[model samples]
Target: MKSPLLAIMLALSAAFPAVADVLKIKKDAPKQYVVKKGDTLWDISGIYLDEPWLWPELWQMNPQIDNPHLIYPGDALALIYDADGNPRLVINKAYRKLSPQGRITPKGTNAITTLPLEMIKPYISYEQAIDSDDIKDMPYVLGANENTKTQTLGHILYVKGDLKVHKAYAIYHEGEPYTDLETGEVLATRASYVGMARAFRTGDEQNGVPSSLRVESVKREIQQGDFLMPAMQGQLLPAYFNIHRPDNAVSGHVIASPRQVREFSTMDVVVLNLGRDQLIEPGHVLDLERQSPTVIDGPRGPRYPEDSSKFEKLLSDASQLFGDESDEENTTWTMPKEKVGELIVFKVYDKVSYALITKNQHPIRIGDIAVIH
Candidate 1:
């Protein structure tokens, strides 16, 4: 049987706006261009506009000319003015289907993806962000396989938790803690996946029985002290993401990623603090906003005259800065959050979610805020 993920990827569609508007064209942009194989909309839009994420604002998708399935190697994109003199990408009426065109086949026969889906595939599928409350109380590994430093697939492991029946669990190691930017409180600890394990037997402390686990799969070396969180038996992130903007407002923070990197960019996988409980779902587009510091100082005033005392002073020198905490008027200045990029949530758990950085106006970093686009 064919894999369902492939089927979903084959049928993925692009989302567009209903109305058109005047586009803010970049100076010295090309008047016309031809779409080629492996050319992405991101790359093409960068060639025409200052903000690549604004492509939908000016791209007039002529359903008559373009095949919704894919942008092939020979499609021509021309810059033209509409009747009202608004600048728009001229949408052709026909895709130049040849005389040999025949019966339409299933989506995957030879169709290309609407966007460069390959870049974020593995991240969108395998990566997940977990909250502390979701996994801390779950089963955890004590040690097994002779308490060896390294453990591989198909090895026996021991876990310490209450298991009523035989089942499967995801093995992982905890990463750094993600703190709430607003309250400065610890929100959750990120989970770095290690492997997958199946419960073979339950260890009974009263009866002196040891819990036994069989490692089904290993993403990394399974070692002692790793965590085992309950997960669906055969679930995986699906390969379908319909480009869209959420109707509701979503506000969250960047919690984690595969690595402990502090910053992220295009195609990077990030875990947002929002999740299933917040009504988040796959294909929900959000904006990554960079929060500016609140302590910008004003221009310096004339400095006080230096003390002329020749004898060494015991007291420390103080600048007596103008913007002091006690002074309310000139103490602080803040700027509005800037939209740095667009993110697409791929997976959602109880209190956390996994997302991919699709479009970036600026480099995004940890603690950046995510709001519905």
Candidate 2:
């Protein structure tokens, strides 16, 4: 028989392998990313994943990201693997400097930042008419006088109605000067949509006079209660617009503006109402409301196109004659899947801002919901 002590030592050696081979962390463990000025999470994720819209997946693994509000320059992102061999994200805490000696401004009152993919959420513009049945619905005219231009573009049908508000409406011809990202310079000229305005009068003297409007360039009068708001034209810069209001329920205090619903072009561009003032710092993460695609059955008649008809006949023959061998699984094919677009808050203004669609796997329409992650 073998010696008792030797047998015990041999058994222990088989059980523990680390002692035989040293365990050490790799010199190049996970990659570290440094945040640069003007960099958003949308752009950051583009560097890592093939699809940037999958930024949310990072949070599912790492909990360091608390909010997606503001990601400033100098912040570091460390990615490593855990014991289970899964990718993990960790934030290296660094002391912020008050007066760094570069063009980048030192951290300010609004310099609060979050982890890799934390608190970022998207809010979509949802609509509900004040006294109407459906949205994008033209309200009927009770009466009319004349002080506004009537031009119907697509869904908006303008007619002269009673101007309900008596307060003098300030005609905002154009917005203030803003910095242009492309030129890296301040642009003095305003965008064309910001048109000029003038005030008029309407309504009775008993309850107070109602105000009306007239367009100078277009040359038309706007009667009482005419809707005045922006409509969808083409591709908007940001992916979507978010409405923020305190009193509403569908969208409570978290919305970017107080509007009921948002409009957008076929592309996933949008305009968020919340800007620099509404705590909407740059680099925020906003969640998108994913929507599934609708399916419709095709007509079951003879095909008009020769190619399609031949193909259909072939399929019919295969289904009836071959019975089981003609790839039966694909007999019913699904239409393309649609998911809402995921947007990343990139630009910020005083009362408005812009977001970019990080991922457009799904077709994001005009009125999807956006919320903070």
- What shift in Å separates residue 118 of candidate 1 from its native position after superposition? 4.5
Model 2 misplaced regions, further than 4 Å: 1-30, 49-69, 80-103, 108-159, 162-200, 204-210, 214-226, 229-357, 360-373
Global local distance difference test of model 2:
0.38
Which lDDT tens digits does candidate 1 get at residues 1-373? 1211212222332344434556778888877765555555556766887655456555444333333334434555567776777677643424334312321333342333334566655554345455677667767788787758878987898878766457878887877776666776665666667888888888885675667888889889987778776655324634335545666787998866766688888878887878777888776778888876444233332222233221111111222343344443222344568888887776666667778787787878888899974
TM-score of each: 0.65, 0.36
Candidate 1 stretches with Cα past 4 Å from truth are 1-17, 20-118, 121-126, 161-169, 198-208, 229-235, 255-257, 276-279, 291-333
Top of the candidates by TM-score: 1
Task: Please provide, for model 2 over 135-252, each residue's C-alpha lDDT reduced to its tens digit, 9 standing for 90 to 100.
Answer: 1243222223433343321112222334434222211122233333334333221222322233344545355444344443322333233443333321123322221211212210
True lDDT of residue 56, candidate 1: 53
lDDT of each: 0.62, 0.38
